[model samples]
Target: MARRGGDDRTLDLLAWQPPEPQRYAEERVRTATLRDRISRAVSETLKDCEQTRADVARAMGEWLGEDVSENMLNAYASQGREEHTIPYLRLLALVQVTGDTRLLQLGAELFDTTVIENRLKPFIEIGMRFDRRNRAVAIAQEEDREIDVAIRTIRKGARQ
Candidate 1:
């Protein structure tokens, strides 16, 4: 039998063959591209609809009993729920008219940070007392320390 070299030429030639480029299947690429476009379109449509809804809500609030600017009204109306419930809409309007981002942010933060709930407890109590059904007494009560603190903070920041 003929002796063969440890590194065989024939084996090296076979191993040297170039690998074929991986081809993405046409159907998968097309489907993914189409899905992405549809998702983008839906997002844009929702944004536009939200802006329009906010404009309408702000207009309605102005017609009610507040000298609410469009910007403030829009901000309040933008917070509305899709369910279109009257009470929820009213709450958004109240929040906007009051320009109380502190309360809004505090409410959201309370759910995330337990310590914030403690800081917010007094304010929440005052707010509950003042809700639509009990506005008269809520308003008549002595000045709210917690609310005063919040308003002062807002004013201080605005001046800066």
Candidate 2:
């Protein structure tokens, strides 16, 4: 309340209760479907080049010196089976051909990293520290506001 005497206008620190922990399902991250993540990345990479799945398949097939089929590409881009996920080599080829990193980004996200690239440069970081830091600050500010509201409520209750 105060250093030593009667004018003790403390925050009534003990009167404040900490908020309850949030439930798992109520946490920030949502459970995303792998199928959707894969399909969206593939489609966005192709779409940026004004290319269809067939065109990408043909180009990638030529680059890989193997038969990457249009139907297989379609299946991969159309949310096919779990085993239908594109390999890393194919992903690199797609990034090379389309010159976009949407798929690469999804791969980075899966491994808890971020992807940064350009025509002559590429960079991958170990962890998503920046994002986590920003989120932590946001949560702290929110909690501060909640505590302010709580203190006001207690002061009001005491007055009445």
Candidate 3:
């Protein structure tokens, strides 16, 4: 479609049709479960981290005030060891040691909640405030319509 300025290369958003919702649901089912994904995530974080597994274990142990061994880390990273999923507190310690906050975000996504970074809090707050203001405006408009209807009913009765 040509733009107002006569450029023929611009795409028109008004012509776009959204994909069917079933497509999205099927895609979700195609993905791995949360348990397997978390195992992969732990392995990936360990692989990408600058610290050695033992060093991470030691740091995590110190953070948790409990013994977190290399074997425990190994089990957490292994997909076959489903029975050995890491506990929440130990996961937090691991996150602290490796600085991989995405591990925390993975769980939050399942609940349809966001894990906001401290730096982005102000920006998110502004968006939330706008959402609240828009809802308030919609509610006020609805109340105004009801008030107008009631006033018209009373005025009509008085005239009769």
Candidate 4:
């Protein structure tokens, strides 16, 4: 077989072998349609609670200090994932105001219950278990326990 000019590879090696074009096109269309439907639903839901949304936006801007957009607000509302807890709490407050039960349930479901109970709670408990005065062996033991639990959870999750 003749090698291609660029890297001396055969055409069979260099040529793209994408999925069947018609199937790919159909998948793309389906994804686009689903996205459109979800967007419309969110838009309609937001419109029904425009005043609450505006309040949430204003509160988030005030809390985040003028660097937020409606899109950011929307993401915060739709998905509670955030680098900081401030946006999550603010979004929750807004949802409370709006009486949006669905968003509330979604947020509750998305909240990382396992991490909160297993990781954060244990860390805090260990911190509190050690006295400020005698902070040598007890602190070390607590820290070790926290680390062990964390490692075990990580291993378990990996296995699963």
TM-score of 1: 0.18
lDDT of 2: 0.66
> Regarding lDDT, does 1 or 2 come out ahead?
2
Q: What are the Cα lDDT values of the candidates?
A: 0.44, 0.66, 0.80, 0.49
- Taking all chains together, each candidate's TM-score versus the true structure is 0.18, 0.49, 0.72, 0.27
Candidate 4 Cα errors over 4 Å, as ranges: 1-45, 52-55, 60-68, 75-87, 108-160
lDDT of 3 by residue, 1-110 (tens): 43567766787856855332111122322336778777777887788799999999999999999999999999998888999888999999998998877677677767
Off by over 4 Å in 2: 1-31, 118-160
What stretches of model 3 exceed 4 Å from their correct place?
Answer: 1-33
What would the per-residue lDDT of candidate 4 be over residues 15-36, giving only the tens digit for each residue?
5443311111222223233334
User: What's the CA error at residue 105 for candidate 1, in Å?
Assistant: 8.4
Q: Sort all candidates by lDDT, best to worst.
A: 3, 2, 4, 1
Best by lDDT: 3
Between candidates 2 and 3, the lDDT winner: 3
Error of 3 at 90 (Å): 1.2
Instruction: Compare candidates 3 and 4 on lDDT and give the better one.
Output: 3
